[model samples]
Target: MSLFFKNYKPNTSIYNRQVLWRCNSTTATQNTEDEEEFRVLDILKKRDRQQKRVVRRIEVQPDRTTKMKPDQNWGNVWPGPRSFHPASVPLPLRQGYVPKGQAPPGKYANAELMKIPNFLHLTPPVIKTQCEAIKKFCTEWPKLLNSEEAIEKHYPVEIITSDYCHGSPSIRNPLARIVTLRIKLSSLNLDQHARDKFLRIVGDRYNETTDLVTLTADRCPVRKQNLDYVNYLLTASYHEAWTYEDWETEKTEQDMEYYNWDNNASKRSLVDWYLKVNNDDRSLTEEEYKAFDISVIPHGVEYKDAVYSLMNDGESDATIKNYATAVRKLLGLPVKVDRDV
Candidate 1:
């Protein structure tokens, strides 16, 4: 080749093409041998046709409520608290949001109907059955407390509490913890001093119109604890009201919040005036004079009552005028208007 075509060393492009072709052929042969050696046997053999898996869906039976007879016992179907189920209940119930002018969604698949608790189990028949079952455990009412008066007399205290039930994660209610204790002020057997002290201690808790004293306790987290707290408060208040302190004895008439006619100077003066006017020499006690029935005397008991009204109740114009007329009559003084006439 150097002698014939000295300038043309085998063309680089042609030589590359021949070398590439040879490399490609060698690679192909090696790949063919490798593929033949590693070939999976019986791949060409027809495989048994794979059996297709057919899914079968069994039809669900109709709801039991649909086949229920009119005389069927509903209590047996719903025995306790549970979410409302449209299919289990025979009624034609429907519940769900509906656009204006359209009927509500049927209860068949109503989430709205099923989300809330229902009292379907508490039918009249079910209630009667429950009562019959529980009747054996209950005792007869006491004969002594048969009447309302007797019951109130024996059990003066009234306690109020509330119970709540709902479809919530927690059963506890804040209002359930509150306990109210109520009793009539008259039923406490408190004397004037004790009654005054009790009223003062309780402040606005006493309702003057109804004479009811109410105490509420809710500081504790539990209902029982609050109830106990109210009971303790009631006992403490009763005992404290009955206790007499030295400071109370030191309280003078002027220091008294309300007027007392029994110990007033007006009463003593009136008694002395009455005795002097009657010329009764015997020194008689207030109780003895009251027993003497001063109403028989001219303007005697009337004058005393008028004075009491002026003192015990604050002096109103009408009471003051009445007291003046009564005093004039008791003293044998002519009435000013009568004298003028």
Candidate 2:
């Protein structure tokens, strides 16, 4: 019985160690089980992490805009046309579309501020400074050309052009390439025939009211080319006006666009009629009539003017009335009353 009791004691010690190991494993697995419910304390711990946030420090720096001097060189700050920068610009500019009650957005980080055009760079002082810088390259204008008349005398051909400025991708404007040339008709050394022909050739381009001929050229791609084209057009028209055409000889006195009192058949008829009535012998030779002055007679000047207005300007009420008056004066008859001539 003593031998059996000693072997059972060693087996009991081994069984005790095995039972402790099993208890530890079961406790460790109890919290990780599928059936385990979450506690209130664990739920609070998860939510508390999201709630606890550190307060951030805002380090505000001083802006340097208040330090600008009244006479500061603005060209150095803004050299040319550019987008608006909030901190750089000193003015308190506001822009943007907002609700009727709401005010416009301020300059700070404003998209509207950048979109609006500002001429801050073109301030008077900046413009004066720029002009002074480039003044060394400019020469004094001639004293002789002080008056507009003197300028026109020396420069008969006045060429006009245009310039445009805007925020476009391309700097060129199509209308700016067009060139206009203007000159007084009297400025050209044209005779009576040439002047008449020039007026006819240019058509509506010549302003009879101002005696100014205007020519515009825009067919070319560039301004310089259009300028040259206008100049060429004026020269071609002037030269062509002076040259007589062979077909022009076919044009009769009646076919002439202009009327000349001295060169018409009416003047010869008047001379012959006067000589037949006044002279015992007709002294109406071509040389004698050519030497004779039409205005020497009593109402001959009035008659010539009436005939001139009738032929040049088509017959109007006033022209017909004037013609009848002059005819009555030449015949020494009393004036008619109350009826339209």
Task: Specify the highest-lDDT model's number.
Answer: 2
Candidate 2, residue 161: Cα displacement in angstroms equals: 1.6
Prediction-by-prediction clash tally: 0, 0
**Per-residue lDDT of candidate 1, residues 154-195 (tens digit):** 999999999988677888988899999999998998987888
What C-alpha lDDT values do all the predictions have?
0.84, 0.86
- CA RMSD of each candidate after superposition: 8.4, 12.9
Q: Lowest lDDT 10-mer window, candidate 1?
A: 43-52
Tell me the deviation in Å of residue 250 in model 2. 3.6
How many residue pairs clash in model 1? 0
